[model samples]
Target: MQIIIVGCGKVGSTLAEQLSREDNDVTVLDINGQRVEQLVNELDIMGYIGSGISFDTLMEAGVKKADLLIAVTGSDELNLMCCLIAKKAGDCLTIARVRNPEYSRETEFLKKELGLAMVINPELTAAGEAARVLRLPTAISVEVFAKGKVEVLKFRIKPDSPLCRMEIQEIGPKLKSDILVCVVERGGEIIIPNGTFVLQERDNVYVAGAQKKRRNFLSVSASAPDR
Candidate 1:
């Protein structure tokens, strides 16, 4: 896909580098010439040095032919304006980062009018992630998808747990509920397990299933012995 990104900050530059590495045609725009030079040297993407809200700059970045346009400048106004211009001028899929609390609340209304595909709130996203960890410290992480009905649950085996040395197949017969442990993490590698997989102490498990089934599944772990 051809993508154009506005701003050259840490997040924007990182996004550019990843897209470029995937062999996507990418172009990055920034107001500062020095930042543009830095992006050119650090990423394989083309760099345009000018205000992203300007038509000339966006045109030079090849926004007209872009499949995606992302505006992530520090200024909310700049991001919104760039997205609006990209939609009006290029009809591309546009995503803008707007941190103002008010804009976030009215995303539905604004998205319809502005032709925006998404609005990202980095702080709010981080806060929600932290809250999930606080609720399930025994699990390294949790992710909900399929409109919050399907879930991905991560758990670490305590060295002293009775099932620490058991094979994955033994859990179905030993446990009272239904849950599928889809992946395992040993050291830093992620493993897709088969029936022969044996879980060791400190092994991280990634389970996926329906939300209610998965919630009840976690209750059987050593962390919930009192339940």
Candidate 2:
């Protein structure tokens, strides 16, 4: 995939490095010549020194041939402009990092009006994730995907829990829940669980399912006392 990253700050540089590592052709741009040079040297990815919103700069960055454009400049408005211009100049998928609280409520509006593929607000997302984890005390962490409809939750198994001695295949029938046990972390080893895999106490389990279903499953798995 050909990806153009606008800005040479932490986010942009990190994206460029990760994308390049994944075998994508990544080009990074920024007004700061030094930052661009550092990224190009460190990541071995292409770099351009110029404002992202400039038409000539984007053209020089090969936006026309880019599969995607990501804008993470310090200024929220600048990032938006970068994405908008990239969309018009290249017709590529655009993702903008808009972090201002003032624009938080308008993210949906911006996405629709600007035809943006995604609008990311890192602070807002982190706060939401932290809140989700706090709400689910049994969960070590909570991650949402598929537009928040699906969730992956990590929680530890307790000694007295029914799940401790249960096989992966028995969870659905015994617990009467639809959640899938996707991964298990036991004794510092990560395992992709199969039906015959018997869960042990102190194991960290990662489960994925719809919100309501997973909550129901967790309630049963974590809230029960010893028989």
Best by lDDT: 2
lDDT of 2 by residue, 83-129 (tens): 99998998799999999888878988999999999999888998998
The lDDT values for all models are 0.83, 0.89
How much does candidate 2 score in TM-score? 0.78
TM-score of each: 0.80, 0.78
Model 1, 1-227: lDDT tens per residue? 99998988988988998999999998999988898898898775688889989998898889889999999899988999999998988979999998899988998887899999998888878887888666665566789777556668787787776558888788877875577888898999989998779898887788876655666567666642221
Best by TM-score: 1
Residue 27 local lDDT, model 1: 92
Candidate 1, pairs of clashing residues: none
Predicted structure 2: lDDT: 0.89
RMSD of each: 4.1, 4.5
